[model samples]
Target: MNITVKLFATFRAGRFDIESRTYAEGTTVGDVVRELNLSEKELGIMLVNSRHVKLDHRLEEGDTLSLFPLLGGG
Candidate 1:
């Protein structure tokens, strides 16, 4: 399956802001994160096709997954 991944804020440093990736039929969100060498603790919010989802959420063909890092500021 093919999915679109969008990285926001600090997550885009040294990496693409958006990319299209191919994965197996049963690939989960966490699988994609690991493929990108990102730890779950580094993630803040996750959205699949505009809906919030958990790391264990399964991805579907043509889905758009947006990942955001934990933001901090006063």
Candidate 2:
């Protein structure tokens, strides 16, 4: 199965450009997040198909996943 992956902010700056990944069915968002070695502090929002989803959410083929960094500034 294949899913689209999108990275924003520092994540993109980190050179995580593959944009997508192919994994076996039943793969969870947390699985991919861990594979990328991204820490919770580096991850802001997670969306699947435009809906906010949790790390444990199961990903399906053709799912579009977007990751963003936490915005911080005074």
Candidate 3:
């Protein structure tokens, strides 16, 4: 299965063009993040098909997912 991912902030450092990636079927958002060697704190937000989703959210083929970093302002 394939999924489109949009990386933001620190996550964008290693990649370009918020492109699509291929993964095994039944993979969850959390699985990919870990496989990518990213930490939970680095995954500030997870959006699935335009809605906020938890790490447990299972991904489907062709699903669009976005990951954002934690924002802090005083």
Candidate 4:
């Protein structure tokens, strides 16, 4: 399955803003996070196909996954 990943905020550091990658069926959002060496504790909002979803949510082909880090500014 092909999934489009979009990283926002600090998550894009040393990474890309958007990229398409292939994953096995039944792959969850958490899997991608781990693959990218991202820390779950720093994760803020998550969306799949523009709908809010959980980390364990399974992904489908052609799905667009967006990851955002917890914002910190005062």
Q: Which prediction has the highest lDDT against the true structure?
A: 4
Ranking by TM-score: 4, 1, 3, 2
What's the TM-score of every candidate structure? 0.93, 0.88, 0.89, 0.95
Candidate 3 Cα outliers beyond 4 Å, as residue runs: none
TM-score of 4: 0.95
Against the reference, the lDDT scores of all candidates come to: 0.92, 0.86, 0.86, 0.97
Q: Root-mean-square deviation of each candidate, in angstroms? A: 0.9, 1.4, 1.2, 0.8
Query: Per model, how many backbone clashes are there?
Result: 0, 0, 0, 0
lDDT, residue 1, model 2: 88
Per-residue lDDT tens digits of candidate 3, residues 1-74? 99998888888887754888999999999997887777798668889989999999999999998988888768
Model 1 alpha-carbon miss at residue 62, Å: 0.6
Per-residue lDDT of candidate 1, residues 3-32 (tens digit):
999999888888899999889999999998
lDDT of 3: 0.86
Q: Encode model 4's per-residue lDDT on 1-74: one tens digit a residue.
A: 99999999899999999999999999999999999999999999999999999999999999999999998779
Which pairs of residues clash in candidate 4, taking residues 3 or more apart in a chain or in different chains? Answer: none
Q: In candidate 2, how many Å is residue 14 off?
A: 3.5
For candidate 3, which ten residues in a row score worst on lDDT?
Answer: 8-17
Q: Write the residue-wise lDDT of candidate 2 on 1-74 in tens digits.
A: 89999888788776665476898899998898888777887778999999999999999999998988898789
How far out, in Å, is residue 47 in model 4?
Answer: 0.4
Candidate 4 Cα deviation (angstroms), residue 69: 0.3
